[model samples]
Target: MTRASYVRRTSEIEHYFDRTALAAWKRLTGDQPVSGIRATVRQGREAMRQTLAGWLPRDLTGWRILDAGCGSGVLSLELMARGADVVGIDLSAQMVSFARQRAAELQTQRSVPTAGRVDFRSGDMLDPRLGRFDAVVAMDVLIHYAPEDARSVLEQFAERTRRGLLFTLAPSSHLLRAMLMIGKVFPRSDRAPAIYPTDPEQLAGQLVAQQHMSGWRVGRSQRISVGFYTSQAVEVVRS
Candidate 1:
């Protein structure tokens, strides 16, 4: 796709999420009753969170985290709870609004320190001017990208992160890829610009070739379904 079409696709996805933020929130991580796919997704999200917790610095008292495609700031809230400051960005204004509101509510209820609070903005991650952070996170955000674009994104992420990056992608396994394609038939999944399965090993190669980083430690995050995997990359020499 041309740059113009790629941008248009992202804009269209933003509009879709803006319209469905509330319902999507309920399905993804909201407190409402859930079953089937919603429950399955939640379980997967929790597992990813656990993986991230282990990947990040154990003591984040003064650390800064960048949450790209933050959605509803769910992970941002978790980071704040651990005393890490967060700057979150989402393409949809509606999603940003909800994220900011929820961040405020969580801060008030949890009585977390101000230094470790989170703030959100509406912006595209592909915007080149976004600054760096101690660690960068883009969870389920790359799901919309085609393969080449995803690789480009990884290189960009390498520059934007100081210590590490955390993300999830649908793997390139044929069975998993087919399941994802079938899932797209449902409107809930179809709203995304596209569902492109990725190979962690190949992506790691891209990172190594393009970003000159070969320290990624990848793992399977979507066990219930053969659909997704997560990757965590940090300097092997970090103290």
Candidate 2:
């Protein structure tokens, strides 16, 4: 994708999460009760987060991790509990605010001994000012981008990621296409930003072929599917 298109999409996503869907997202990520469909989505997200966590070292002491697109800081908190010093960045200011509040609450209530900490910020995840990380975890962050844009974003991440990059993408499938069609029926104002489903095999092939990603190799992967949520987790490790 062209830089202008990428920027436009990014801005759209920021507006959706930061303004249009902020309240609903806060509830979904919190302990509040939601509808059955949202319940399944919540469950699926939790499972996916656990799956990503499992891919990391059991003990993350001294690790410097980046939680890209950290919504309300659930994954960031989990990583912190595992002894990782995490930097959680998101495009939504409201989301980052919520994350900071949540983190503060957790730290006040818990006395567990761990080497984990988190600095939540609202900004572009690809910002160079954020500096390098031992690893980066971006859950459901790239699903809005076209395939080529997604790969380009990954290549950018690869440059600063010393060890590995873990992220989720909307997988291309019949069910996913059907879901997209169904989503189109909703009013544009009521619907979330469009999700671009990407073929995992094609994405892997592109990663392998990209000269910029030559130092990295595709690693483990898994797909998580629930009533309304389906995402593929992919790992890329430095060679």
Question: Who wins the TM-score comparison?
Answer: 2
Best by lDDT: 2
In model 1, which range of ten residues has the least summed lDDT?
A: 230-239
Candidate 2 CA-lDDT value: 0.89
Q: For model 1, how does the per-residue alpha-carbon lDDT over 118-167 read when each residue is reduced to its tens digit?
A: 87889877666667677777777776677677666766677656666666
Q: How high a TM-score does candidate 1 get?
A: 0.79
Q: Please give each candidate's TM-score.
A: 0.79, 0.94
Cα-based RMSD of the predictions, in order? Answer: 4.0, 1.6
- Residue 225 miss distance in model 1 (angstroms): 4.6
Query: Which 10 consecutive residues of model 2 have the lowest summed lDDT?
Result: 106-115
